[model samples]
Target: MALHFSRDEFASRLELVKARMKEEKLDALLIFAQESMYWLTGYDTFGYCFFQCLVVKADGQMVLMTRSADLRQARHTSIIEDIRIWVDRTNADPAQDLKNLLMDLDLLGSKIGVEYDTHGLTGLNARRLDHQLTSFGTSTDASYIISKLRLVKSAAEIEYAEKAAALSDDALDAALRLAKPGANEADILAAMQGAIFAGGGDYPSNEFIIGSGADALLCRYKAGRRNLDAVDQLTLEWAGVYAHYHAPMMRTVIVGTPNDRQKELYAASRDAIEAIETVLITGNTFGTVFDTHARIMDERGLAKHRLNACGYSVGARFSPSWMEHQMFHAGNPEPILPGMTLFVHMIIMDSETGTAMTLGQTYLITDGPVKSLSRHSLDLISV
Candidate 1:
């Protein structure tokens, strides 16, 4: 099936890049990174090395250069104006081609921004290109220019995201329902994986997180063979990929009814999530959510830094980026914007009572407010 967006939707995306290029004062932006490529072209071939390096001219001319092998796929997938294929990846020397592409647009005298964070400049190709260019520049995060353009969802993009959200919802429901007192973490993970695939999702960016009991304090707890104890707390988080877009979600469930301490912590954490959800807005900084969540945990004497990850970028591919599109993994004071995707996972653990709990949800900044992509509840589930 050929999934396509309306012409107006596509035009908005192109305009977005033009606006960003003007802001950055760069002639044309070069993108070799998969996340950036997917964000601009909406084509995800899952090619680590075979994908094209794209250059978006400030005049609204977008050109993508990929390896010869990917020419067919690139031609079919790109929704842009120009497609250039490099017939050779190695000895043939595409440096001149890149140099020529820049020279054609009078970019030799202009600034060229390269994404070093997502696509590093440490390869033979980069060195060769560096030698060929008269003037070259690089930055840690090109996502700033990219995210500003990608944050707002068009009507068609929202339709795909909605479908992804439904798939994630069904998968989470399956995992929660299948989770039981004697079930192992592997069992839960497998069930969720099956459900996600069954629901029509293609890939998961990171390994699915299915932490249990005492292991809840550990962030990104990978699924293991450990059987769920009667009182084990299970934290579930995974993102679904459809046409390269991400619909991420997380859920928390206990093997059995929690103790008083566990209940209190769960209540506090849920309160934090709800509070953030209510107050989250386009102009609000991600720090706002983190600080408020920290306060709820502080009052309960829970270690805030124990599980320290606020949220990250959600877009065409699962880069797990922040709202600000920061190059580094640190707090960002940038205000949220519509179409920006972020994953906020609030967690709590009390080993004294042998209970660990957490909940995560992805939200898209909207015109009026932030909307939850993960429609699941915050209530602690007991299987």
Candidate 2:
């Protein structure tokens, strides 16, 4: 089936944000950047360029602020009711222009919060924004506010993500079917990507690396002129967005019967992933999961090569980002509440052997148990 999401799903998420805003003592949440804008509004007019900003206040009023040129398309597509369009000047900074529009809309001094993301705001842009905010006396900084709201999963979002993971599994199915001793890694990539479009999926956030043999030395590495060998181990690390949510994961593939050494390591990784999956129930601290995996690897003396965590974030988008959750994650200890979903991938890269291994799965946090959404088998496959 073609992949898509219901508009009600996004609407429900916005309401979730509204509830978060009330708890956070926020009047409205100001949104910039592409991902959050799409997550809240359901309109994705390629916000990668040009002016696209939004203000969602608590009065059930969500206003989208954009330039005059973008207003027509935005109103035609955005879920927001109020469309505030600003006229562009011949020679002016868009940031300053946005500030002026905010002041005109009386949003100044409204405890507005901005997302600086990983990088701190710079001096020039900060000075310009400060000068503009001073004109109307508004307060602003990186609140890490939107993140907490984004952590918990909404029902409709899980539904779409579940489907997205299935679509990705199908993509890998097609890729593995095409894998052969004579084919290059790119050969299977083309086949996998073709299946993605055939199933109505869009582009992956990062490149999908499907290399084998020498190419597998570096983790998150790429496929080169190196050809797949019948005896060589294969790795497939890929995740893409469906309806703007992240469905990140990976899988291991072998072209034919595996040798003794390869088979042993593969069994260890596969078993380790299974052990983690079995215990990934709701309310368990993520550290508990990591410590357990670390112990398993410690028993094998493979702890140093094991990653920090067994899983990471899965949402309406596949991020090319560094994970920094304040709770229930590494460096931060908080309970794993129900309504959060994540994709767990265990990767082992051996540069000396020119080999790599991966075992991945996706799960949703529920009151009773963690429901596994990825139905793909976790065994060594002979393609």
Candidate 3:
């Protein structure tokens, strides 16, 4: 099997997950989160856009219910041997298949925990499963049971994250080299993604957030692309993924001469990140860290240019977003801890001046201070 971790490690992860299941009084867990599946057994596949689930019994027995397309995928990538395939006929109901599987295991009447928030389980399918299981047993929303267990990184996980971070630095360097006057934004993005893949990295959970000129002020990825202006800022946010672990980086490059206002914004953005770093150590509240960023930007008179949240937890994630559930924002009382990966971005987009300046990097939280994952300098780049 192509399991990413050793058998012992996978076994330990299962033990942790099952322990959490017991704590929640969950007789069984219906894991629909792809990340949770991969973490438990190295079941890697993009087939999660369809219906699939990994059922873990309280006794620690696990089974994967998926489509035929992912049959070989499960065999090769994961240690899951007892795989069940659900047919794709128009009238076929996989929920019924799941119910049968539960009955076969003599768990049909037991309380089960379902991952209601994952993309792997659609609303229609969830309702169907809930309706069917209502007669058999109770299914509770227990997404956080497995998710919270994954917040802290193991040693092997951190190693993969470190490699991803270095490759992300390489990607940023390649993209920066291509950020010249009259350069195509598409080419820059290609260079960035290509660098990561060339370095033995996997595709990130989401598309790169890249834009130039007026579009640079935006944060999320969009449909159209543009060329770098001779005197404009090119904003980029990309990640290097390895073994599904992500190390994301963000920076804004000036194609030509930067105005005084742009430079001032960049300085404040850098200072804001530095201030946040001071409070990102272990034992600090995540909100405290965000407050540092907010205070820096607000005190610098750039509050209007800031984003609502400063950063979030990062880990092995699949598309839609690389952001983990734990976020650093106002009123979020989540505490920072060692072995956590976080990405903090000092995003400042001044719509009034039509300029953008953003600086971001990922870090591994240690006992004392956090270690920078991205190798690139946090200073604003000009080319």
Give lDDT tens digits, candidate 3, residues 143-189: 88878888889999999999999989999889878888888988988
Worst 10 residues of 3 by lDDT: 373-382
- Off-target runs (Cα >4 Å) in candidate 2 are 1-12, 49-51, 58-60, 67-73, 84-91, 118-131, 134-143, 221-225, 318-329
For every model shown, what is its TM-score relative to the native structure? 0.84, 0.85, 0.97
For model 2, how does the per-residue alpha-carbon lDDT over 134-213 read when each residue is reduced to its tens digit? 76654555345656666676777777677667777877788878788888777788887787777777776567766677
TM-score (C-alpha, index-matched) for candidate 1: 0.84
Clashes of 1: 6
The candidate that achieves the highest lDDT relative to the unseen native structure: 3
Q: Which candidate is the best by TM-score?
A: 3
Given candidate 3, what's the lDDT at residue 225? 81
Stretches off by above 4 angstroms in model 1 are: 1-3, 49-51, 87-97, 104-106, 119-143, 221-224, 318-331, 349-354, 367-370
lDDT of 2 at 251: 71
Error of 2 at 129 (Å): 3.7
Pairs with backbone N, CA or C atoms under 3 Å apart (clashes), candidate 1 = 52-66, 151-339, 244-316, 312-321, 313-321, 313-322
lDDT pick, better of 1 and 3: 3
For each of the candidates, give the backbone clash count: 6, 10, 0
Report lDDT (CA) for all predictions: 0.66, 0.65, 0.89
